[model samples]
Target: MFPYFCLLIVTSFCAITEPFYKKQKSIKCILLSCFIVLVLFSGLRYDVGMDYLSYKTWFLSGRGFSEQGFILLTRIFRSLGPTIGFNFFVFIIAAVTLYGAYRFIYKYSSAPLLSLFIFFCFGQYFISTLNLIRQELVIYVFLGCLLPLIIERHFIKYTLCIATCSYFFHYTALILIGIYFLDRHFSAIIKLSGIALITISSPIIIYLIENSDYAVYLKLDIFVAKVTVLQYYLLALSVIIALLYFKCFQGKPMTKKDILFENINYINILFGIMIIMFSNTPIIQVISRLSYYTMPIYIILIPNFISRLSLRSNRLIFRYAFILLYTLIFLVAITTNGKLQHYVPYHSIIF
Candidate 1:
């Protein structure tokens, strides 16, 4: 708790004061320093994170894992000598994850430090890197690579990228290809209709899965659903904020670059609506995983949305309001989320 709190304070200060620095060099240096700290913090953990023990055990035992990429990666590391292979594997994965995150922030975020802060504090994404290594790797790849392709309307490239990533990492990443259609180039009717189709078909999909031979493999458990209250709050807030932004800033002249954030915000709203619709259903897990593909965009969406404001007072109010809200969420996650408790009393190999 102490270590996590320290990181929160330090990163929060960096994020808040980052705008004061005018030079890109200064900003880059700050980002690099913070990035290094995050990588080390994530990479060097010892007996921390929910899957730490399992990952280490699997690596040492030479057991095959579900993801082919994880299997090949472990094999490559195992050849390096038993003393360092497993730990180094963890370190390399951490580096890749943070590198993807940093690239995404550098490319898209209006406030990179604020984005970094959210990467750390928002729903414990930083901590999640230690647990869902393969999934997070795929997620950041989507953020850094596939998302830009979606914005650029490069359907072929986006499809190829998702295919390659899904083959290597988490297969769930294959679902990301659907996001390309939700781009702003498409008509509002098409976008809403697509979302509506998915929403309406969810029940049929769930029923078929439940009745199919795959049901045993999927292990769908209504009693053990993992969707959290904080997640619900975040998704609901995102929809409310996007709606308010839409209402307040309607018809404002949007720069071409603003379109990117607008599209992301729009997708976030659409997904948020879908998740809320499934809030009571047994398939919330399925809906929630699908929604998470776009949820990380909230870090970029909120800051950039604030920048679009016409009034300085409104921007300031919204900025602090978001900071306050996200801070409370971080606090709640650390104190309450049982899985997150595994991250505390922060251990490191070097220590």
Candidate 2:
């Protein structure tokens, strides 16, 4: 909680001050503080995330490395002993993921620090460092590589990035590639219609996972869960936000670059909603897994949409509205300690 608030203060303060802080030195300090708080909070924490023990167990056992890349990574981490190695591994993951996200938010967002705040409100960074370690690292790294290529419409480069990411996290990376490609190419009518198709097909996905011999190999059991009502509310909120951003862009005059970036984010939010809707079926966790690629869009889209509004009064109302909205989301996340995602009270091996 201490580190969490520290990060919030830094980002929020910088959000207000960045426009006036023109000096390169001042800008560096602000950015440094942001990364410093993020790294320390996420890097030093011990026994915090739900998967902490499990990840430690894997490190100690020296297993679960699917390829030479991970095998070498684990070896390097464990060279100093399990605890030290695990913390180092965590710090590396935290640094890489947070930095990548910083680039993503800074590149596409209207308010970079505020977009980061939204990322914090959603608990994206903490959960990535603490719980969903391998998957999140792979996804963000892959995502960073994918964004530019996607905008350039360089399919070959995007495919290579996906393949590279697969080396780190395997089939999960492939799943994201498939989902994102479809989202990018699909028309609005087809996008919504495919949602219906996916909803109807879940039972089949479930049936195959439940009874198929391949389920064990594919690890489909991990995704088994019933979608809750709270998730439905979140899903609805996402749809509203996506729609709002889409409509916001409709009336604006923008360059091809701006339009391309906004439209990509538009796809991200919409696809994220589609994936969340699919959670209502048997393979609930799969949607959660898939949402990672698309969820970052909201961090920027929300801020971008509000800033691009036609009325000053409307912007003010939404500014406060989001302040309240993010505040509640942040508080609820803190109270839960990421229990749902397996994160919580800050702990550190060094302490």
Candidate 3:
């Protein structure tokens, strides 16, 4: 709890100070400081995250690795064995995840520090890294490779990127290939209809998968539970913010990057709605994983939308609103989720 709060405070301070710095060097220093804090705090943790024990055990025994990349990483670190090696493994994962996220935010975000704040606070992305190290790593890979290809409208490159990432990483990431089509300049009506169709069809797909041999792939029964009420509220809140952005851009011209980002956000909201719609189903985990693929868009979308506001007062209002709303969500999540409950009384190898 102390460590998490410390990170929030540090990130907030950096975010507030960033716009005033102006100098590239000063900005880099500030960003670097925040990144270091993120890496060190995440890397140093012991028994302080959702899957810390499980991952450590896997590292020691050399099993439970699903992805080939992760298997290779485990084997490389097996040389150290036991505690020391596992700590190093966690450190490497933290470094890779934060590096990818920070690099993406720096490249795409209007306010990188604010985006970092969201990365830490919104949807527990930073916290979840302790549990989903491989997923987060694979997500960043998709963002780095698939994003540019989608924005530039390179079909062949996009397909190849998905195939390559899927082979090396999680097969679930292959679900992201759907984004390439969704990224196109489809009319809003068509896109909205598609969102509705997907949401509507989720249960049917879940049933079919459950009945088939592929049920093992989804692992739907292991973590059977409903998404929390607070989670649904957050998803609803995301949709509202997205709608505000949608209304703002109506009838306005958009650059290619902006158009794709805009659609990406809409797709993100669609996943949010899907989670809410399927809150009761066994397929909640699948929806949650799919949601993660688009979740990074929030770091970019929310900040970009706020910056686009026509009035300074509106900007300030929304900025504060954003922080407050997410802070409340963060509080509720930590209290409610069993895995997040483990985040309390943070421990580190150094201490």
Candidate 3 pairs with clashing backbones: none
TM-score of 1: 0.85
Return whichever of 2 and 3 wins on lDDT. 3
Worst 10 residues of 3 by lDDT: 332-341
Q: Candidate 1, overall lDDT?
A: 0.74
lDDT per residue (tens digit) for residues 173-278 in model 3: 7887788765546686887798879877877877887799877755555666577765576577577765775698688876777777767777766777777666
Model 1 root mean square deviation, Cα atoms: 3.3
Global lDDT scores for all candidate models? 0.74, 0.64, 0.75
Q: Whose TM-score is higher: candidate 1's or candidate 2's?
A: 1
Please count the clashing residue pairs in each candidate, in the order shown: 0, 3, 0
RMSD in angstroms, all models?
A: 3.3, 4.2, 3.4
Cα error, residue 1 of model 1, in Å, equals 1.7
List runs of model 3 lying over 4 Å from the truth. 144-146, 154-161, 199-223, 335-340
User: Residue 70 in candidate 1 has what lDDT?
Assistant: 64
Candidate 2 residue-wise lDDT, 1-351, digit = tens: 666666666666665454455575666555556767777777777877777777788788878667556667788889988777888987888877777766676666775656666777666544455678777776566555566776666777777777776765455677655533432333578656756676677567657765876556345445446555445555665667657645765655655455544455555544455455445343456666566665666677777777787796786677667766776867777777555654545667677
Query: Which one wins on TM-score?
Result: 3
What 10-residue stretch in candidate 1 is worst by lDDT?
Answer: 217-226
Instruction: Decide which is better by lDDT, 1 or 2.
Output: 1
